[model samples]
Target: MTRVEINFDGIVGPSHNYSGLSLGNIASTTNKGMVAYPRAAALEGVAKMRHNLALGLPQGILLPHPRPNRDWLDALGTRPDDVPETLRPAAFSASAMWAANAATVSPAPDTGDGRCHITVANLRTMPHRSHEWPATLRQLELAFADTRHFAVHPPVPPAFGDEGAANHMRLAAGHDAPGVEIFVYGLRGGAFPARQHVEASRAVARLNRLDPDRTLFVAQSEAAIAAGAFHNDVVAVANGHVLFAHEQAFEDRPAFYAALKRLLPELEIVEVPASVVSLEDAIRSYLFNAQLVTLPDGTMALIVPGEARETPSVWAWLEAMAAGNGPIRRLGVVDVRQSMANGGGPACLRLRVVADPATVDPRFLVDESKLDRIADCIASEWPEQIAPPDLGDPALWARIEQARRALHALLELDALL
Candidate 1:
């Protein structure tokens, strides 16, 4: 069976807003209290999927999870009407739009049963994102329901914080071949919470039944985390056998590299030094958070945010790297400032799954026509803007619910409803 990597981007929901719910994310905090453009944000995400399709890549979509999560409020012994002001934003959060945090995926070639394994993340570090798993699990079960090709597991217990694929990386000679999987966990990040725990990573590896000898668990640099690299993907990304990272991404670089080399000697590291682009600039511009993907022609391209180009040092380093004789030969820039403002980049917007497209749910897959329909729905239904006060308005909540229902009807995914 032939398998290709599909980039499943989470469609930005109608309730998209910047509540500054994520404590460690600088962008989110900086943009908090500003009016958000939900309609434009969602259309921007749809355009990104279309961009992937034009690149000759398989694209899929994970619908926005239901917002104003009434169930969560009920669980907290409160109703929406009487819910405390502090808890209001959590219920309406659109954080699930960053699919990288939705789940950790192990492709078929690297799993024990020759089946793809997807384990939903228990994002317990932030209260706003903690309740996302249940809704996320529903989507995963539907999308990868085929027993022959996929095994979807519920989130690991919340005692250990797991931020999914954001903190995970897989490297292989080819998508269909056995690969080395690296799980990066963080112990501390000064005032920020270290989101990915080693224990959680270990549990996920065990659940997926990955080969111990081929899997390496490494620690994220405390400095990188403190500098605002909340997830490993923020500082490093792996596609095929290439690892593009910031120089300070890992705690013990030489040791991790040695262990990785022992597992897979063909590894290629495109480490951007701090001398050229400081870690502060790297995190601010989300340079490493860009998606490093292999193009259809076998050459690789880095899909980066427009912010990368705007940052002088980051752009200079990227241009020099691409111009030189290196494994990454091209650069693709995308405008996701709507998501960028909330601390997500092109990489954060997607979850990579290497599998036979035929086995996945057809409804979840996308092409240009499907995107047109999705975008049209957004234009007509999504709120034009949402301010802080709008979050508490029952009218806004009703509109948001109706907008999601309309999208479900359009996609014929009412099963998720």
Candidate 2:
């Protein structure tokens, strides 16, 4: 039983564009109405998946949910025929490209039932993203349907406001070992609304059947959230026993570390002082959102965004960190600027699930061969670029729909209706 954490990156959807939909997401608001190259975005994503494969890391992919999700509009009692211009184009938003918000997964080792548990996020914070829960739930149910190995649960009731893995972090002795689960919540953060509710985090822990003793609830700092750390991942991320975070990431910094050390003595806490890396810089470059993975060689690597390489402070920090002879000795930078413009980074674009690949739906698994085919699909069928104004054009929808159909055929996924 070889256990590994497989990254399932969301294929950037054709309707990918900037609408300034997310209120607290600075990038999304700043770059709204800009031209987004959907074709390039997917190609870049596939290349990243292939990069991991070349490193002998197991990877997986998640298909974009059918977009211009008119069905949801119908459910919301909005007539598609006469949708107001402001909300009309927003309907075609492809924000689902950020799969990290897809679910909060608790591996089999930590769950009471001895089965991997996945709970989809309601994503009720932003209007453009609120309708994504149903599609996300459907995908989770389809991809992890093996009852013998996995358990898929719905989002905690709507009133609780759970933002999924973006607000959750799991630290374990190893991929296959049980360890502490940290549920970070923002009680009330300045003018910018706090996305993760304390109740929401508790609900997920209870629903996932996580042992209370092994779980810890931490408060997200008010300053951090207002500084564009809308989700905890924007400020903190944990891999194995290591937690890499900014100094201002939590309410009581020293106390959080002391408590974690008390509970999990093996914990390796890496604190980046505010002087070294300001919260604003961290949010802009998404340094904390980098995917930190333990390679097969028993050392870790930070899969960062290309933007980090351009930022002097972040790049300097990476160089120093890699040179310090720490367990994290490698850096892999990838270009995901299109997704980044919409307030997501390399880590934001993926959902990490630790389990045997054979236990998941084969269509969701990625191998070298599958990566090649996905690249081919992107080059041949995906749109070159998508602008905000293009969303209202009927032909754009047709092309987007056809591109997904081609991808389904290539991957042998079930056809979308």
Candidate 3:
């Protein structure tokens, strides 16, 4: 059987602090004003990337729209014409207001066929509260008629403080299989009552009656960290054997090593460093607006912010495989200037639709020795090609042009996605 993988796009939401909403409030927020514009633009870039990766079709699902608080556009000086056509409706919808800030979607694996499927989470909202279900499974069934397995978890009660379960359900439901696995974490609703927990457990047990092996139990980790704070810890379990981090590991050095020892007492723990951990912090920061997409050639691509943070905003494409980190390959980077005037990074600008391993030669992977030469070539020649307009301050324009060039070079790399 082909291995299944899960990729996450970072958080997305409205910028309540923008001037359009703030009105009389003079205090400037950290991600206020033009900053919010780039965030939106980055999301657009992600969508475009998703479209490209899916071979010009929708493959994966997009998370729930973020609620940046009403009047965020006003605070940012965003007018009706400023918003993209696809996002304009979402910006005003009530669903956008009450739903959890993020959701998950998936694209069909490229099995050589051009047909694809996409799944999205269903969100419900009441007067003052909101609730989530594994509703996306139902949607997946509808979207993909050939779906193999179906998984269902008991409905989770609404929690004013914690929305992680809801988000997880959305992601999990995007699976395209028929075998369903339900994981019970806690009480259905309200406070974690003892009786409620017992009832939930019983319900989960009853569901497993259909197929115990197919219906697996997953323990919710209290220590689960946010995608914003760290790179996701990927664990693959099958036939009683667990695979940590697919073929290699990312940033979970000390803790993950120990956890592996305990989880696989009889197995050897191997240390494999990440090939593309460079600019990880920057990548995480950018993920808030975009996602990393692996192309058919195994290259990875993400959009980055252009301004605000200490780093410059540009679309970053890397050839991790070329660096011999893992099966994933990196090509280069692409810089895009946000028309909205918001400073955006690679992650903020794009979404992923499809991620299929290519059948072509692996020789496309870049050699480590050649990386610096490539970077230097792009860094030096980029400025002359995309010169900044004279309207902006000379120095500021120069900096913007430089960032744009860097991004262009990154994107220009063959098979870089």
Write candidate 1's Cα lDDT for 69-161 as tens digits.
999999999977788898999999999999999999999999999999999999999999999999999999999999999999999999999
Tell me the lDDT of model 2 at 373: 84
For 76-192, candidate 2 gives per-residue lDDT tens digits of: 778756666777655788888889999899999999998989999988877788888888888788889899888999998888788899999999888899979999999777778
Overall lDDT per candidate, in order of appearance: 0.94, 0.87, 0.29
TM-score to native of every candidate shown: 0.99, 0.97, 0.36
lDDT (tens digit, per residue) of candidate 3 on 255-327 = 5445434434543322223343323333233322333333444344332233213332212222222355543
**Model 3 lDDT, residue 408, Cα:** 32
Candidate 2 Cα outliers beyond 4 Å, as residue runs: 415-417
RMSD of each: 0.6, 1.3, 14.3
Deviating ranges (above 4 Å) for candidate 1 = none
Q: How displaced is residue 66 in candidate 1, in Å?
A: 1.0
What is the alpha-carbon lDDT for the whole of candidate 2? Answer: 0.87
Best by lDDT: 1
Rank ordering of all candidates by TM-score, starting from the highest = 1, 2, 3
